[model samples]
Target: MREFLVEITTTIPEGTEPAEVDRRRAAEAVRAKELAATGNLLRLWRPVGELRSIGVWRAGDEDELHEKVLGTLPLRSWMTLTVTPLESHPNDPGKADAAG
Candidate 1:
C-alpha cells in the first residue's frame, strides 16, 4: 500500500443546527476508530492552535484512497481535503531493512 499525507479542513454549512453538528462529530469519531483498527489510518493529529487536521493513511492507490477511505468519512461533504502521496527517503528509518 502507498502512504499518503492528508490535510482536512472542516466547516459545517451555515445555519446548520447544533444538534446536527454534534451528530456528525460523533459519527466522524467512530469512522476514525474503524479506519485505525483496519491499519489503513496511520497517524492522526489536530494541528496545534488550528482548526484543521492532518492524517497519514495507507491505500493501494489514489483512487482507492479517495473512494474507500476519504469517501467513507461522515463529514466528507463538509470537509475540504488535500491528499499528497508519500515516498520513503533513503535516510528514513527502516529504509535499509525495506530495501533489503
Candidate 2:
C-alpha cells in the first residue's frame, strides 16, 4: 500500500451549535481509532498549540484514498483537508538496510 500524508483543520461554521461540535468530535475520535486499528491510518499527530492534525494513511491510490478513507470521516465536512502521496524511503527505520 502507498502512504499518504493528510493534513486537516476544522472549519466549524459560525453559529454552529456547541452540541453538534461535541457530537462530531466524539465521532471523529472513534472513527480515528477504528481506522488506525485497520491499518488504513498509520499515524496521527497534532502540532503544539495548533488546531490542525496530520495523519499518515495507506491506500492503493488517490481515488481509493479519498473514497474509502478520507470520504468516510465523520467530520469531513467541517474539515479543510490536504492530501499528499508519499514515497517510501529506502533507509526508513521500519525497514532494514539493504546489503551491497
Q: Please tell me which predicted candidate would have the highest lDDT against the true structure.
A: 1
Q: State the lDDT of candidate 1 residue by residue for 9-86, as single tens digits.
A: 998899999999999999999999999999889999998899999999999999999999999999999999999999
Query: For all the candidates, what are their Cα RMSDs to the real structure?
Result: 1.9, 2.6
- lDDT per residue for candidate 2 within 20-47, as digits (tens), equals 9999999988998988888999999999
Separate clash counts for every candidate: 0, 0
Instruction: Indicate which candidate wins on TM-score.
Output: 1
Evaluate all candidate structures by whole-model CA lDDT and list the values in order.
0.94, 0.89
Task: Give the C-alpha lDDT of model 2.
Answer: 0.89
Residue 96, model 2: lDDT of 58
